[model samples]
Target: MKPLNWFRLVFSFIAVTAVCGFYLPGLAPVNFCEEDKITSDCQLHIRSRSLLQNEIQLFVNRLDSVESVLPYEYDVFDFCKDEKEKRSSENLGQVLFGERIETSPYKFKFRKDESCKKVCTKTYDTSNKKENVRLDFLKRGVELNYQHHWIVDNMPVTWCYAVEDGQNYCNPGFPIGCFVTFDGRSKDACVISSGFNKKNTYYLFNHVDITITYHSEESESWRGARLVSARLEPKSIKHNSQENSQSCDGPPMDIPKETTGILNVTYSYSVKFEEDAQEESGWKQVHGDVFRAPQSGMLLSVFLGQGTQIFIMTFITLSNRGALMTCAVVLWVLLGTPAGYVSARMYKSFGGEKWKTNVLLTALLCPGIVFADFFLMNLILWVEGSSAAVPFPTLVALLALWFGISVPLTFVGAYAGFKKTAIEVPVRTNQIPRQIPLQSFFTRPVPGIIMGGILPFGCIFIQLFFILNSIWSHQMYYMFGFLFLVFIILLITCSEATILLCYFHLCAEDYHWWWRSFLTSGFTAVYLFIYAIHYFFSKLQIQGAASTILYFGYTMIMVLIFFLFTGTIGFFACFWFVNKIYSVVKVD
Candidate 1:
């Protein structure tokens, strides 16, 4: 490569990095702080018809006004022997366990309720200064979404301290709680003997618990952090009350067993003030980073949409091996010059009538197949309320962009090819293409495609499980960097496996390497589909016809993309081997 070209690439990358690193902070979405007993920041955006169709049952959780309190619904198993027994009926009734899925937090709107509007205006005005100017604030009703989290093992217990005659302070914890509210508000409602304190304001003295609950497909419910432990730090905040000993230094707070049922590896939470985003909510853009890892199979589809474009283009542009990448490079040297130029030469080799089919199919078929799968799978996720579906419009645009560029390139090469003479192979074809090489399942295109998937899968299946868990399970998938690397590995494996198979087939005199290579590598997608089916059936018990259809719908998309990526590797690899072998032969 020319130094200037290299310099440009490096400079371009640097420029992009600078912009993302520097300017992004300001451009990035703004986040607000929340101070509830259990709080977390996350997003579950829905976008597209397929996704919305599946998730129609889930209404938008919003807090429209201040006078509203979000009603959270949860199922109490009624099995907890006592408060401490709020866990699964395991060997030990004292064990605690559960789940938590923190949906995206809501950004409170400034729009006030009608009733609160008048009071809000009057309360802030500093007009008539008499009667000690006492500011009497009205309690405006607000709304909250019900967040559901499940706890199977470690049940939650509450620890309380008697502060006033009618008020008390409570925290979620057990055993020797050490950590305090490293982050929480100073004055928030606290639950005492009666549960959550709605009418009383128990000044937060020590710590706070922000239990982030999100949906989990593994246990087939929502789950999050069980009370690991916590401490109360009264000295951190500025207290105006005449109380020197605001907090007592004790061993630790141990919540009693009676409060355990609330931890039933089962809980629910909705949303409040959701009108702004709700006018449109379904499959929103996916967040969290995308990367490759040893266990990155599950994220294959998620990362492909974002990184595939630049990634493949870079690979192709950088390799710039062009004819060198094919077996033709060797043929070019043996027969010299144009004899081994693959694009033009193979264009002729495929026969004019079939050339278009070959190139077009090679370029478009794989992506088309993958998208079909992707579209279908997205429908399934949409139904199951999973976020696996890539928006159809975006997907179509992506396809158009890829094929539009690639189609012309292939045709141009073909035109150049058909106008040229046939490549003089070191060995000439007989009256007809050779046949009769019976092979094992591991060698033929079909079985080879099937087997090629195993190693790549072995490298990533474990990771894929987690990825699928994060997606269907609704867990956090912020491990894109690691996944990206695994993507690289899968690429290598696909290419090498295809190449090895192609070389073997050619040595066996099987010249029909076109579709064979594509199919062989593309077969990996089949395995992926199989695994997905296994996951859905064995791992997830998602009810509803929508969920079933959506699962397979998104699974198909994953399969389709996988097909393209793997097929491309195989086709290119075999193409290289063919050129190299023919070029080396002494075609006299």
Candidate 2:
């Protein structure tokens, strides 16, 4: 080896060592219970008590609203839990994620068949101007269909209700009542019951029956009881002053149209002890309903195909010694099977005639885009004499990977895909397409597609800041768990948001959903690119045209990958949703 090559090798060793030293701890296994006993870090443990005592915390938060875009804690409503309880100390990641772990007034300890033990009552005097102001603010949140995200023992308190299939759906959160507009706009929660159909009235849930179950271990080493789970049922009741806190089972609470009278809302809960073996069987009644796969088979295949390649690259980079580009090529070439299978099946299902074009596009289109961007960035690096530039030999190797290995593997996969029959849709397509009306500007496809990305972007923009810092500012990012979680959230958000917008468009009689679904979620990458530009100008101080070009070039590669990933999610989700919905409905 040349002298400069030897020096470069040594420098690379030193750099890798420094990176490992900083991040190895984060990757290493950790014991949340260090002293043979579970610590607070474990977030759950039971300490022995002389007298039987088990207190479970119930917390509520307002759900997603356009007003603030952030949920407010139920304690903000001032309906009452002990104020002296110390709030849980959050980890750095939790704090950054904006998680709130605090005690609420709705707490319950082990007791006999307790129905509605009033925790506290909030009396808002309509006559008092200050009291009325508080009441109005609370009403406004309810009017927006704000929900309650209740948590107990660090687990979401689920709301179990039956759906159309006679199967019960357990939602992580429930609405905090809803308003019935005078114009007959029945809000989401209002539609669940006819009692809520009363015009021009706001129904607030003023009572709760909480059930906290605990299990006691006989082992002398452990004295306290472990909480199994906590459940609550929110009820809206209209009780007169004579019936104050007397019955929780009474009729739903109706806050009259007139907000001038004194409004008293009572909150309460109960707790009990149970054997560990005595698990609640209600949640298990719908075992048949529990096993369901996510929709959009083809889209998932594309995503998994790309994800497998990325995962393989990360794994090899950490566990073995080889150039990153080489590993990516090898993994990607191997992943061609899935890619071809998915694409071929999807294309066939779409009634596409050109198999060769589908296969070629799948194998080359995205890679070509990435390579073009990378080559441009490399040229800038070469011009500036930057060490980051890829050498000519490496470029040749990359081409070998793409043409020699990746292309062949992709062809093999595509060949298999072409041999297989097209995937069958549950619903048959109609011979005549429905005519779509002229959509307004706001409801147009372009506007909806643009707006669809904002939410998924919002979910990830905070995490993106750190990722950008890692890449551009030369900061170490070791939060793989957080990153993985963000990835899942992004996937879910992208799918759901796309599905929602797709549904609205379909309801508007627009059948052009295939591309719309993909673009809607994919547009989030555009927002990401925009943010990168903002970050480059405002947050970064990169000097010189070469560096600027390189920054944007690499950013484009990332944006492209993200675009495909998010777009795949939306497409598949919407695809599955449309199939499912269309299959269930009778079509002429």
Candidate 3:
């Protein structure tokens, strides 16, 4: 009946069709054998070959116990060390998260199976004080059920075993050992086997059964295959004589709680291979236009960096809350350098001239906002004579951490970033801009941004309930694994939704998708804020204005951080998608 409505429907249909058609070819399975063999209905044929000389290296990451928030390097446990140890290069995020991945003693050749191969032997003599101390620390690690994270080919070497109800569970990390109490009660990994019944003893996982699954590609050009998955089964085995033992068998390696004599732990492993039937695939994108500087590029870059810092802080702090407030503040303060670096790099790439302003904004903008809000909240607490009020000394310490440490580090990072050359774009931009076409209601910026966040919010709303409960109701939140999975899902949802809407905007010839992209996913924070208001009234039972002010004030801080985090995710995703499409498509 209406011409505008009719036009909208036709335009939407055309855009969807064009996008699908453009992406469909890349999504389809292609024959690796020959370019001529590639067809619409071509079957994906991965031709893999067994490597003749493949060296599989196992890397040991930082050790962490469920009982403690702190993590330590592998060397702290005094386990068998690699003679020529080398550490893998870690990113800023990994370093901040306390990941210390280094070469381990475990090494194997591809396709060549080994059974009960001895790695190294560790002898702890009680006569030596240092040895005794090391032994005690090892025992403490066992008692606390400290986990060992092993990496193979950049993938986690999972420990898969049967759990309760006969269902199998795969743990990304395995415990250093198990502990048996004086009363004969077993803890952690001790429950996995009935053999760990020895009283007042520590059982060390000195042996491992490693299974590596690889995908073979049988191409004339390439000869070697790639590892798809790696799994290991840890065991505590005792050898009657280290010199005489050929196979890892006899009994569990148990150490007395209070040992007066010498103790030995012989680290060993067995390796096997399995051919993986399926091959993993990834979507490819182009780059160029997406990297093009947007309007208010400097401010956006600063926000992006701050957002990334908040994301890292939130992710790492979620596992334990014993020292949450203090740890989070410390992490945020320490993380300023990375934030400044990211902001300066992006701003520089965007052709920003005022480096000083960009760095200052990056270091101060978001943190200042949070501190100001917190100070206001603290004032309310002080006026109400609440015990929750932060002491003046604590404020001074925070200021010291901010100005004395964070500010200086941020400047250093900014300097480093500015010194580097700007990132090269895949395609060059024209000095003159193209005129954008008239947009319909659906294609408009605000409506599209509003719609972009709904899916991501939908993905995390249930998890948000638990988080809110942990914050307000003082409920213990320890389901970090599930929370992490939900976080990943939220990111995916945000990226896909933002990309889809971005495509729609691009199809409509609306080139101004930069801020829109960030805001599109960032709008999830608005929904989160709305949900908090609903939760405040419906779920929480509060009576005072000060209490309400405190609740909303703290919640606002969370919402702002979340806004930055989700917005950064969406912005980067859409940026990548736009770059990919533009680079791939033929343009005049």
Best by lDDT: 3
Task: Estimate, for each residue in 1-588, the C-alpha lDDT of model 2 and write its tens digit.
Answer: 854356468769977985675433223321112233434533343333222234444655435565467767665655565677556666798677666666677655444455666666689999999888878877877787676777765567876666897998777776677788888777766777787767888888766555555554442134445555656666677654554536656677766567778888766554443445663232122122211222443443444345334444444443443464566567666676667766776766655667787777777777888888888888888888888888999999889877887777777877887788876554445454444567767668899999999999999999999989988889987765566557657877998999998877765656667678888998999999999999999999889767787888898889887777778778778878876654433221
| Full candidate order by TM-score, most accurate first | 3, 2, 1
Report the CA-based lDDT of candidate 3 relative to the real structure: 0.82
Report, for every candidate in turn, its global Cα lDDT versus the true structure: 0.40, 0.67, 0.82
Q: How many steric overlaps are in each model, in order?
A: 113, 9, 7
TM-scores, all models, native as reference = 0.36, 0.48, 0.52
Q: What TM-score does candidate 3 get on C-alpha atoms?
A: 0.52
How far out, in Å, is residue 574 in model 3?
A: 1.6
RMSD value for candidate 2: 16.7
Best by TM-score: 3
Can you tell me which runs of candidate 2 are displaced by over 4 Å?
1-329, 586-588
Better of 2 and 3 by lDDT: 3
Model 1 lDDT, full chain set: 0.40
